[model samples]
Target: MLRLSQFIFKETRERLGTLSFLINSIKFVTLAVFRILKGLFMNGTKVFNKEKIMQQNNTYVLIMAGGVGSRFWPKSRNHFPKQFIDILGTGQSLLQMTYARFLQICPKENIYILSNQDYKGLVMAQLDGIAASNILLEPSRNNTAPCIAYATYKILQQNPEANIVVAPSDHLILKETAFLDKITQALEYTSKNEALLTLGISPTRPDTGYGYIHFEQEAVAGVHEVNRFMEKPVLKKAKEYLASGDYLWNAGIFIWSAKSIQKAFQTHAPEIAKLFEQGNSVYNTSEELGFIQENYPNSPNISIDYAILEKATNVFTIPADIGWSDLGTWASLHEVLPKDASNNSKSTDHLHLEATSNCIIHLPSGKAAVIKGLDDFIIVDDEKVLLIYPKSSEQEIKSVAGAMVATYGKEYL
Candidate 1:
C-alpha cells in the first residue's frame, strides 16, 4: 500500500512540471511577437512624424509674371514677355531660370506662378511637367496689391503656416548663390519672426530707376530695420542716398509669412483683402472663372509697396550684395550683357561698321542692321517693326510701342 502511494505522488509531480514548462514556452513566444510589433509601430511613427515636420516647414514661392514687358519691345512682344525669351542665350527662359533658382529652396509643388489668364498656355508650355492646378491666373490687370493678396489667400488656404516669397519674373541676378542664400535667410527669418522682409540690394551706384529703403539703425547680420521707403529719387538725391551708406535699392523681392502679409493687407489694404477673401470661396470650384471675371477688375489698383510697405511700421530690409538688376530698360540690359571691343552689344546677325562706342544693336536673322559712329544708341529689329533710338530715351520706348499700336492697329506694336 505505501509503495503504490509513493508512485502516484511522483507521477503527479512530473505532470505538474510538464505543465509549468509548457506555460513558460507559450509566454516566451507571446512576448517575442509583442516586442516585434511594438518595434515596427514605433519606427513607423518616427518616419511619419519626420515627414510631417518637413511638410510643415516647407515654403511656397510665388513668381509674379503678369507684367506686360513693353520696355523690352521688338524682342519682347505682347504675345511673349521678356520672361519667356532666351535673352541670355542660356537655352533657358528667364522664367525658367527664376524657377530653377527657387527650386533649390522649395519643391516644384510648392512653387506657383501668378500670371495673366492669357499666359496660362505659355506658362504650361514652358513648364511641361509642373501641375497646372498650381498656376494661379488673374482675370484682369489689377496691379501688384490684388495679385499678391490673391496669391496669399490661395496659399494660406493650402497651408496656413506657409512662408511665401514674392519675386518678380524678369529681374536679372549675376550672383545666384548669394541671391539664393539671402532668400533662404530671409524666409527663415520671416517665418520665425513676424517681420515683413524685403531684400534690398546694396546700392553700388546711384541708380535713379529703383526705389530706396533707408536703414534706420545699425544693421543686424547684414539686415536692417527699415526707417522709411523712398520712391524713385532724382539724380542728385540718388547720389546723396548712395553716399549716405544707410540706403539700399529696393529689389522687389519680399518674404513674409502668409499670416503676416494677410494682416498687412487687412490693416493697410482692406479692399484688396476682401476681394481675395470673396474670390477664395470660388477657387477650384466650378464657379471660379465667373467669380474672378466679375470681381477682379473692380478691385483697387495699387502697388503693394505703396499700399503696405510704405505705410507699415514693422518693415525690415535685408541688405544683399547680390548682383541685381530690374532689367527695366534696354540700357539696363546693355549694362548687364557682355560688350564687344567697341563697347557695343549686337546680336549674331547684326552688322556694325564704323560704330565707335556705346551702341546696342539687336537684329533678327535675315535682317540688315547698320550703325555708323553713333554713341549710346539702341537699334532693334523684329518681324513687324524696327526701332532705332538713343539709349537715353529708354523710358520713352513704352510710349512708342503704344503709339505704334494706335497707328498701325496692333500690327507694329
Candidate 2:
C-alpha cells in the first residue's frame, strides 16, 4: 500500500509541475472541507425550526396554460397550442420546460397544471409522471381570476398550508439558477407574511405589451409594497413609466400562501370567492368536475389583477433581473432566439443569399426554403399553411387566423 501510494504520488507529480501539483492538492482539500461544512449546515437546518421547514416542504406550483396562442397562427393551432410545441427548438415543449424548472425547488407530485379541459390529453402527453388528478381542467374560459381561485381551492383541499407559485406555462426563462433562487426567496418570505407576492421582471425597455406594477419607495424583507397596477399603456405612457424608474413589467407570476390568497379573494372578490368556497366539501373528490362545470362559467370573467391584486392592500412585488419573456408574439420570439448576420431568425435549414433582414421559420416535416431577395419579413411554412408577411404586420396574424377559420373550416385553425 505504501509503494502504491508513492507510485501514485510520483505519477501525479510527473503529470503536473511541482507548484501546479501543490495548488491542485490545496484545491482538493478546500473542496473536501466545503462538502463537510455544507453537510453540517444542512443537518443544522432541521434543528432550527422543524415546523417552518415542514411548512416549506409543502410548496406547490401551478402552471396556467389555457391560451390558444393565436398570435403564432400557422405554427400554433387550437388543438396543438404553443405550450405543447417546441417553439424554441429545444427538445422539451414549453409546458415541459416550465414543469422541469419548478422541479428544482418543488417535488414532482406537488406541481399542478390548470388548463382547458379540451387539451387534457395534450398536457398528459407532454409532461411525464403527472397524475391526471393534478390537472385542473377548466370547463370554460373565464380568464385568470377564476382559474387561480379554482387552483387555490383545489390545493387547499390537499394541503391547506400550501405555499403556491402560479406561473404561465408558455413563458421563457433564460437563467434557471437565478430564477429558482428568486422563487425560493419569495416562497420563504410569503410563507410567514400575509402577503400576495408577484415576481416582477425589471423592465429593460418601454414595452407596451405587458402591464406595469408601480412599486412603492419603502421595502420590507427585500420586497416592495405595490403602489398600483397599471394596465397596458400606450408607447408614450410606457416610456414615461420607464423613465420614472419606479415600474416593473408584470410577469404574471405570483407567490402566496393558500391562506393569504384565499383571504384576498374573500375580501376583494367576494362573489368569485364564494363560488369556489361553496365547493369546499366537493374539492379533491369525484364530484369536483361536476361542481366546477356548473358554477365556473357563471363567475365573472376577470383577471387576478382586476379581481384581487389591484384591490388588495397587502400585495408585494419582488424585483428580479432574471432573464424572462412572455413569448406572446412572433416578434418577441425573434428577440429571444439567435439571429443571422442580417438579423434573421430561422427554424429550418435555409439558404439566404440576398435575404437581408427577414425571419424564415418552418415547422418540421414541411419543406426546405430558398430565398433570394427579401428584407424585414416573416416567412413561415407549416404543413398545411405558409405565411409570408411583413414583420410590421405581425400584429394582424391573429385576425388572419380567425378569418381563415371563418372562411375555410375549423381544420385549418
Best model per TM-score: 2
Cα lDDT, all candidates = 0.77, 0.81
User: Each candidate: how many clashes?
Assistant: 0, 1
Lowest-lDDT window of 10 residues in candidate 2? 44-53
TM-score, every prediction: 0.83, 0.85
For residue 100, model 2's alpha carbon misses the true position, in angstroms, by 0.2
- Kindly report which residue stretches of model 1 are placed more than 4 angstroms away from their true locations once superposed: 1-57, 284-287, 349-352, 366-368
Error in Å for residue 326 of model 2:
0.7
Q: Output the lDDT of residue 250, model 2.
A: 96
Off by over 4 Å in 2: 1-55
lDDT of 1 at 351: 67
- State the lDDT of candidate 2 residue by residue for 1-413, as single tens digits: 22332344465568777778665632243233323333433442222232343346778888998989999888999889999988776566889989987877787788889999999999998887799988988888989999899989888988888999999999987656567767877888888899999999999999988999999867877799999999999999999999998999999999999999999999999998899999999998989989999999988899899899999999999998766889998888877554555666666443434645756455453355667677877777777888888878888999999898899999989
Worst 10 residues of 1 by lDDT: 44-53
